[model samples]
Each structure stands twice: as structure tokens, then as C-alpha cells.
Target: MSSAMTNERLARLYDRIEIQELLYRYARGVDRKDWDAVRAVYHPDAFDDHGNYKGDIDGFIASLQQRHAHIEQSMHVIANCIIEFDTPDSALVESYFITYQRVLPSAGDARANYFLREPLADDEAVQGQAIGRYADRVTRRDGVWRIEKRAVIYEVYRGMPTIPGGRLRDNWTISSRDGRDPLELLRIELGLGEAR
Candidate 1:
């Protein structure tokens, strides 16, 4: 390949890595329920459409805060990130995200953690399997890349505000990340594995 072609390829690869890292940060922020961190991933005037939300960046995130407050814990998984750059500073990205919310006990003794263990309840977990895509137009402003526009799409919303461990009570455990595979990490995060 010519020098110019080689340089272009390397630049594209770098851009892809950067976009993936940015997306991972976005997911981490959402999972941690850090609204401020989540907001920082976008431009000041970015647009978003999260199905449950349809507004500008600020308005959309405000709605997210209100909704997220009702859940106890959430996990956001993003994968298969495909970023296509229109220019060195601008791109469109489509990524897959799976979000899970642990529902709080609404009835019975929720605080009572210890009791005769029975079947896990279904009213305590909500899993969203989203074939979601984000359309982002990014630009480097002030020597930093920021998403100028964003749109979100959700493909599946499974389960509900029910207990996630109810069905798989015997499968909950921690993972020791000595050198875990990326796919394994994904499965564990998605509730597809027992506690290790």
C-alpha cells in the first residue's frame, strides 16, 4: 500500500478504537447511574431519542435520571460497535447495548434479606435486550471529540420490574477476572451464567 493509504488505514483503526472506548465509558456511566458522566459523552446541543425519551440532550438525560432513580441497580452492556467516519472528526456509529435493571421489592418483606429461600420472584427484575443503534455525528471541539448528534433505538424489552435472580437463584456468583474472555464477561453480565 502507498504511504497515504497506510496512513489512512491506521487512522481509521485508531478512530474505531477511540469510538469503542468512548462507548464503553458511556455504558459504564449509565450502569453506575452517574448522570453527569453520561452527559459528558455528548455535545452541548446533541439530540437523542431513547424511545422512552425524545428530546435534546439535557431533557433526555433529565428524564433518564428520574426513571433510573426508581431502580436499585442496573447493568449496561455495549458490543459490536461499528463506527463509520465521514471525516477524520465526524462519524456514524451503531452499537448493541443490553441493559438490565434490578427491581426493588414493592410488596412483602423486601428488607428482610434472610428467610426460608423460595423460588426467586419475578417482580424484581427488568431486562432490556436492545438491538439499539446510535447515530452520532462527532466533532473535535477544543481539542476534544464530542458527539454532536445522537439517536437511540431499542429493539427488545424483556422481563419487567421483577426479581432477576428469582428464576436462577442457584446461579448467582462473582467472577474472578484473572484472564476472563470478553464473551464470558458479556454472558455473566447478561445473567447467562451462575455465580462463579
Candidate 2:
């Protein structure tokens, strides 16, 4: 192959690997509940269009922190990523994400309902899984590609009835405009708006 062809092939391979790593990092951060790490996978101005959090990165994290609290354990599986290179510096990626939510009964609730003996079994509290997909627009900035925008569409939620939390309603008020701090909004929602 010519040098140009070889270079093109190598670039494609590199982009593919990098994109896979990016997705893996996102999954790891989310599963581990490492908000900072999850935040690092996106651009500073990134926005997400999740059915739960239709706003910026701060909104997304706030929503996640609230929504995932009821879930004792969860897993995110990413696959079938179709990445199209618009140039050497930008791409559009569509990835399939399947998330599983395992509910842990609260201490009081578990003791009252599911406790068959003095001690609880390890597996008794698991709820089930929720599957979804991620449609994203990624861009390379400073030589590192990151998700610039993302929209999560849930295909199915096959688990126990969801427990309502204050987090879901928090993002509903966020405008599409920039400069809103999600944490501030959360504090306001909780009636702790005063700076500590």
C-alpha cells in the first residue's frame, strides 16, 4: 500500500480504538458512580438529552446521583457503536447502552417484607435490569476526542416498580441556555440554597 493509504488505515484503526476506550471509560465511571470520571469523558460544554436529564453535564450528573440512589447496584453494557468520521477531527457516534438496575430494599422495608431469617441473604434484594441506547455526537478537541452531545433513549425498564426521588424533577426546570449550575439548583430544590 502507498504511504497515504497506510496512514489512512492506521488513523482509522486508532480512532476506532480510542472511541472504544472512551465508551468503556464512560461505562466504568457510571457503574462505579464516579461522577468526576464520568464528567471527564465529555467536553466542558457537553449536553445530554436523556429522558431523565435533558440538559447539560451538570444536570446529567445531578440526575444520575439522584436516580441511581434507589438502585443498589447497576451495570452498563455498551455495544454496536457506529462511528462515522466527518473529518480527522470530528465524528458522530451511535452506541447501544443497556443498563441494569438492581434494587436494594431499605433496611426497614427489607426487614418488614423480604427477611425470612435473622440475617438477609446476599441475593434477595436484587431487582432487575433496564436496557437503553446512546445516540452521541463526538468531537476531537486538543487531540482528544470526547462526547460533545448525547441523548439516551431507554428501550425497556424490566424491573420492579420505580421508587420516586427528588432528582427526576430537578432537571425539568433547567433551560437550554448555558451558565446554570445544577448543584445550585439541587441545593435550592432541597431548601439548602444558602451557601455553606
**Per-residue alpha-carbon lDDT of candidate 2 for residues 34-127, written as tens digits (9 for 90 to 100):** 6776898999899989774688899899987775664555568999888898888888888888876555555334432322344544434545
TM-score of 2: 0.69
Superposition error at 110 for model 1 (Å)? 18
Backbone clash tally for model 1? Answer: 11
For candidate 1, write residues 84-103 as lDDT tens digits.
Answer: 77777788887877776554
Give Cα-based local distance difference scores for all models. 0.64, 0.70
Best by lDDT: 2
Q: Name model 2 segments beyond 4 Å from true.
A: 106-126, 161-196
CA deviation > 4 Å runs, candidate 1: 105-131, 164-196
Q: Which one is best on TM-score? A: 2
